[model samples]
Target: MGTWSARPFGNDSAADWAYELDEASDWGVVSDALRVAAEAVPSDLDSDDAVTAIAAAEVVARGLGRVPESAGSVDAFVARVSAPPPEMVALAVSALAVAASAEGELADLWEGDPEWLAENEKLRSALTTE
Candidate 1:
């Protein structure tokens, strides 16, 4: 996974996904990532897809004015893409839940890492907050 930290964009997959996000002309990229993760069979979810979905959820949180202090590249993404629709917050939350669940590769990879789990919960909290 080439992960160096627990943050959403702290991995190779997420960094690559961030580049795609920067090149995207609209919000569809974000929605597509979230939708794909959210709709995946929990037992069959890929780690790359899970990572990208979490990154996409981070973008949605930023669009909703919930930008974290350590947003990194996601801040730049928010500046380029228009705000995500309000409905996306729910989708983002759903994606996070599925991606972080025990059924997915990401969850298995992060199995004993409390820091990774905490980071995932933080992103979910950002999306669910009013």
Candidate 2:
């Protein structure tokens, strides 16, 4: 996982995903990642997928005008890309739910960590709120 913190983009997988996002010419990168995670059965979702999904959701959150303070590369990606379609916000919300579910590796990895859980909840709140 190579995690240094509980922030959405605080892991190696998410940092890699952020690089992909930065290089993308459109929002499809975010949409594809969110769709894959949103559609997967929680038990079948791996840690990398979960991490990427969370990072993608953070992008969607930014599109919805809720940028997190620690959005490193994501801030640049957002500035370069147009805001995602409204539907993507819904997908992001769903992806976040699945990624944080009890059956997923991400949840397992952060199981006993209050900071991780709070960070996940914070992302979720960002996506769902106006």
In model 2, what lDDT does residue 8 have? 87
Alpha-carbon local distance difference test for all models: 0.85, 0.85
Best by TM-score: 2
Candidate 1 lDDT over 55-104, as tens digits, reads 99988988888865435556776777778877788899998998888878
Candidates in order, TM-scores: namely: 0.91, 0.93
TM-score of 2: 0.93
Please write out the lDDT profile of model 2 over residues 23-43, one tens digit for every residue.
777889998999888999999
Off by over 4 Å in 2: none
